[model samples]
Target: MATVCISGALVDKLRACAEAGFDGVEVFEPDLVSAPESPEEIRALAARLGLTLDLYQPMRDVEGVDDAEFARVLRRAEAKFRLMRRLGVDVVLCCSNVATATIDDDEVSARQLRALGDLAAEHGIRIAFEALAWGRYIDDYRRAWRVVELAAHPAVGVCLDSFHILSRGHDPAGIREIPGERIFFVQLADAPRMELDVLSWSRHHRLFPGEGSFDLVGFVGHVLHAGYAGPLSLEVFNDTFRQTDPARTAAQARRSLRHLEDAVARADPSLTGLEMLPDSAAPSGFDFVEIIAEDTSTIEHLLARAGFTSRGRHRTKPVTLWSAGRARVVLNEQHARGRTPYLAAIGFEVDDASAMSRRVAALRTPRAYRRTYDAEEELEAAVAPGGTEVFWAQAADEGEPAWVSEFEHGGPRIASPVTGIDHVSLTEPWQVIDESALFYTATFGLRTVSATDVPGPQGLVQSRVLAGPDEVVRLPLNVAPPILAERGGPAALSAHVAFSCADVRALARAAHLRGLDILPIPANYYEDLAARVDLDDDVLAELRELNLVYDRTDAGEYLHVYTATIGNVFFEFVERRGDYAGFGAGNAPVRLNAQSASSAARESGGFGRVRA
Candidate 1:
């Protein structure tokens, strides 16, 4: 568990780790030193919390020194070993000396470590020697292991840290070569790919597993394959996590461990014998999207223009279900807030909702509950990292779903080409972008497809997509950088829903005839498109006439159209042909430019009238 060395008061960290379901903890020496409690008191607290004191960590700068300094370091090691005896910890993590280590001889280092190991053995404690990435004499795990081998002490063993090894670009496969009994401890951390120095990068930019770019599954698999049967602990030093709420950070950290374990178990069949979480449920498609607004008339009008008809009205609340083919939109006016027409909830169709809920519960995420009416369906729900509500429900077993009985459906039908949800786009703050990505990936078993930078009116928007294996449920997360308040608020680069259709041109024509406020496209876009793709003149003319944008990749072609902003939300219509897999991201700059112009025109009272 991360409680061993993470930030926060020692007691709070232990309580949080216990509550997060960690069986053991590594105790950082500083946390112990700064605590008001004595070693005996800390040990009792760990006992009460039902946590084992696995290891006391990070006795730094201990080896590769001269005779006099070595003598002094042994005295310090003796004191720590006595403390560990009282603390009920069996092992201490000795980091390679980064300072005051003049001797570069492995035999000298080994001789010094042997003496320390002798002292630890007397105190009934062990030493797990680790290599610091910035160590003066030894910075590689393999080099540290060689020194440990030379020491040949029963009380001394090598500690392998993923960050120290991977951050230095060292191959972890060599870990399999070491004898399993010699590998005493293991520490895990993931970091983004950066060009900065290792010290600063490890301290400030470390992220939880699946949140960073590191390939930790392979790293852990190698360690397990070597028959290392110890607690897989976390030793992250992230600046942001240290400053955030400790309880929330602990919960996220625990979830990351489960995610990593599941990945490793999948990669190595031999390791599947170990206890692991259930496999992620496969998502079929989106069930419905819900929006919350103060007033529903504007959203209703927009839905009408897009050829969606009111299928049912909630029996007990001011909510309505709008549908077109397999696409469903629930306009919920029960709760209103600062942003009008904000996306409130998303529902997914999974193979088994109950199994998915069980897996999510084991990760320590909170479950969401709501008041249910007499005939309403009670689907399992959970709160996501960004406070968005996620509902899981399986397809109906027979007839209509149980939830539909709560709504009354009797209205004139509107027919159009829109079929189902193509994708749902969500906006996240810069700080929580990575957290949100990890949440969806871990919860729904989604894979991040690609990330791109989009030029917005305010600044560059970082966009990434999380999609299922079959491309059924796609969520595009957009993060807008902080902009000065004077820049007319950050651009609305997110908060839009796209609907799939058989033919985008036909849907655009239908929406235009229904008086939808279509976003105007510049004629230059068509001219550029003509130069880019080889298409018939008639097709190009039709695209320009309906204000549609076109893009084609080596795999396939895409066509899409956008609607003017309605309150804080907008809509999109898309068509894919020949296995087109992207969101037509190449057309984002033009769309953003046009939307900015439209907003400016609206502010000046010069834009065309929008029907309400």
Candidate 2:
């Protein structure tokens, strides 16, 4: 935590950090200077909250200067040391001077650092020297380490920061060369790959570990391999995080630490001696997806047309379960606010549901409880950052299935066509994308793939996919374009679930027979597909008849079709042959255009019912 940092009062920041389960905090100097509390009072507050004052940071522009300037910096350092004495902190961070540096020689800088270390030793404190990426002369960690080595003082050592090392394209493999005992502290931060000045990028664009493209797992692994066992502290500086609520930001920071620990542990099993929480059980597959709507008629009709049958009704609530093949959809109408339908919950089939609950609790994520009657199967759930509930349940076995007892199956069991969920699309505003990505990766142990930009009717939408290591479950997250009220565009594209089948043509034929309103595709798409890929004439004709869009890569071919938007949600059916691993991103623009047109037609007329 950066002090005088993040959005909140000083006391509130400390309290939020403690409540969010951080073991200790690095007190930023600016925050402390502005606070009304004396050093003694703040120390007492931290003590009362069972928090450790780990570091007092940062004493800057104290090295690589003229003699007179060095003398002035020495006096300033003494004053801060006295303050740290009162605060019961033994260590202070000294960042490389980015300004006020006249000397360029490493020997001069080391001599100055040694003089400061001598002062720190007299005060019973140590200095952790750090290298900022934008420092005047010493911009690299290796350079900072060289000065620390030349200083040759007991109280002087190097502080390793991930951002400074990684943002400069410095290889972390060199970290292992530094003696473990000389590495005094470690700071971690992640950022997306951006083409900008280092100072501006570091100040505003940093994100939490899994939210960004940095390889923090490998970074931390190198640090651990070097035998530095200090607290893994987070020092993020982002415009969005600073403006958000302090408590929420603190919780997210803590989760990132836990995630980093788990990832490092998995990367290096040889580091078994290091303390870390056990990784969450890997997800087997999706169990069920629940939708909440005031009137389930439209959703039910769409599901029926997609070849799903009403398999069961919740024994205790006003919910119905629709099944197709092994896939299940729960229509939860018991507590709906309006006619607009939205995804309410996602259930995962795991090896141990209870273990997942415990893992989530350890990360300080809040649990959500739903009212249940006697003899009902209780599923453990955690609330995601986007207000979606994630339920965990064990995979069903031959002996007994939990769903059989939870729902009353009275309708005929129709032979289902769809196999399972290929992917689930989640939409969020651009600013919330990083937060949502961190939530899923930390809570569920999912790994993120590279982000791709899809051209939409409104604008270019950024999309990233998160999936398990084995690719059993996939979640494609989209950052929606800004709403264009003048152009009459919706705020976001509606969320949808895509079901996979072995033969999409057969499923489309069944859907057509059931009178489903297939989203109309323009003939231009077929001509484009024909020029792009060589497809059999019969398959092309069948796809044209079913209004399906096509995309083929070197790996495999993708065929998919979308349903008309019903309320705030929609559905898609997809078929993948060979090794097609994409979500037909090439066809996003056409789908968005068609959906927008349909929405306009529906609004021009009254919101009349559309039957399947």
Can you list the residue pairs that collide in candidate 2?
A: 4-31
TM-score of 1: 0.92
RMSD of each: 2.8, 2.8
Question: After superposition, which runs of candidate 1 have C-alpha atoms over 4 Å from their true positions?
Answer: 4-7, 337-339, 397-402, 484-490, 522-541, 609-612
lDDT for model 1 comes to 0.85
Candidate 1 Cα deviation (angstroms), residue 205: 2.2
Question: How does model 2 fare in lDDT?
Answer: 0.84
How many times do residue backbones clash in model 1? Answer: 1
TM-score of each: 0.92, 0.93
Which has the greatest TM-score?
A: 2
- Candidate closest to the true structure, highest lDDT: 1
The sequence of per-residue lDDT tens digits that candidate 1 reaches over residues 443-470 is 8889888899998777787899999998
lDDT string for model 2 (472-577, tens) is 8999888777664234354245788899987887888888887787787877888888877898888787788888888889899899988878776888899999
